[model samples]
Target: MANVTAKDAMQIHGRNPQHLVEKIIRTRIYDSRYWKEDCFALTAESLIDKAVELNYCGGIYGGNIKPTPFMCLLLKMLQIQPDKEIIVEFIKNEDYKYIRLLGSLYLRLTASSQDCYKYLEPLYDDFRCIRVKNRSGSLVRGHVDEFIDDLLHEDRVCDVILPRVQKRYILEETGEIQPRVSAIDDLLEDDEDTEKESDDELATSTRDQ
Candidate 1:
């Protein structure tokens, strides 16, 4: 089947990368109409066209556990196992939020803890509002940061149990990673600089008075 993983693809976490998604959900994706039609024979270069159309993220939904188009594309990515540089470009493409998210999810599934933290943590500042469809088939509003957080910390996201990610602190202690500086830290530093400027201006005015 064209949908089967590529011949040259390597195992992720000791199994097929597509296996990162649960078997039942993976089956649903394979049987999905979107998979049969839109996703058929899509190459890594061609897949970007479909990814730009996504507006929401989810696994199965409704009573039938229908896989979302987002999930279908995710499975295709795992099947193809596109080059890391290609996936990184997906995350770096700020013009399309779903494309960025698709890359982030792929990284969490296949990349190392260090790689995941390295690429994904920078997106904590994205803060773009997104639509997330739950298992119940209802869409809820969420931020980019929230989705990234769930991918990092939650055991399961969109119905797949994530691969174990080593605790960040452990990596930091072992010197594999440096201490994380959140986007908030940068914002606070900017605020302090502005406040100091105002204080200096006030002192100058008082001296002139």
Candidate 2:
């Protein structure tokens, strides 16, 4: 294993020398896995690479596991361009949940194709919200105005539209929701009922028992 200092590790990965050294020192103190000099260096390099990739796409590193909304916006911006093959590749990866988040943002920010909008309508209904500011802080506008205006001739969309869309999608995806099965209490009640019925029948059969 190569003996690596925090400064050497950051230099090797072309990261911010000062920040990387600070991060390595912090991780060495808190994260037991980074206590080893070689392991710490390798982890730092990986973090730097991941951070660079995210920055290129417009994301901010949120600890080791997640990226922020700014990153999603960046990815959306990249997707609008004609030549970014790597961005396309990243969007195609299913494991990249951020890609879906970016797509949602793109749809909202840009006028997407009608076909794309229709395809995403259900998901949008599920995830998106409209807010209006009045004298009070904020209020949900819902999709009532748009759906009614577009689908019907109404001034606002129906309140039921989103719920209906979500219900349809759930039905299509998971079949119909089955009735919940009895738990122990219900089962015990059923058993007691059966016993009562049996006792009644025995009383009827035996005249003087």
Candidate 3:
């Protein structure tokens, strides 16, 4: 990892580096009244529930609609002061695509460009069939890497602004890759009521078909 810092990148964007959370929230607009009614001041830890319930991954869930829980949780991670180690752990755990998606999003937003390339490049082979919403307002199947490709290369993926991550070799000189701490080991799926919508339950329309 180079000595690249998030603050430097954030400064180039001309926004206060500390207020990245506000940027995420202000940039997105979701039609789910549930979101408007809720989703304010949610801690990064609290957003895990929503991320787990997110069964699909896509830039858009419907026509002109906002991103899904995968994106929302990523945004929330930015909001609630996430621990990079914990988020990296999420990326390594392949049990759930949405969780990994959240981790990937975190890295894209805050990790060094070198770290992003080192970690995310290999996931290009992940051919898991997750659900996505197409432009004609149809639900369809897509691969995880297909989404990752755009995220790695494009300035904005999933209609979210991403600060350019420069390479960071500074950390390497310190001779210690930060030890991974278990910040979220206790986050088990206990909320049975919040179980994700099944594939059969998912409809062609994000709101209503």
Per-candidate TM-scores read 0.90, 0.23, 0.61
- Compute the lDDT of residue 102 as modeled in candidate 3: 69
lDDT of 1 by residue, 99-186 (tens): 9999999999999999999999999999999999988999999999999999999998878789999999999999998898987998
- Stretches of model 1 off by over 4 angstroms after superposition: 190-209
Among all windows of 10 consecutive residues in model 1, the one with the lowest summed lDDT is 155-164
Query: Which candidate, 1 or 3, would have the higher TM-score against the true structure?
Result: 1
Q: For residues 25-122, could you state the per-residue lDDT of candidate 2 as single tens digits?
A: 33333343322321233342232234333311222222352323233223224222212233333333444434433333333222223322343343
Clashing pairs in 3: 1-168, 1-169, 2-168, 2-169, 2-170, 3-168, 3-169, 3-170, 4-168
Winning model by lDDT = 1
Compose the digit string of candidate 3's lDDT tens values, residues 123-179: 777879877655455677878887777777788765566777643345445643443
- Compared with the true structure, all predictions reach lDDT values of 0.92, 0.33, 0.60
Report how far off residue 57 is in candidate 1 (Å).
Answer: 1.1
Local lDDT at 45 for model 2:
26
| Alpha-carbon deviation at 186 in model 1, angstroms | 2.8
Model 2 misses residue 174 by how many Å? 31
Give the Cα-based TM-score of candidate 3 against the true structure: 0.61
Stretches > 4 Å off in candidate 2:
1-92, 122-209
State the weakest 10-residue window (summed lDDT) of model 3: 1-10
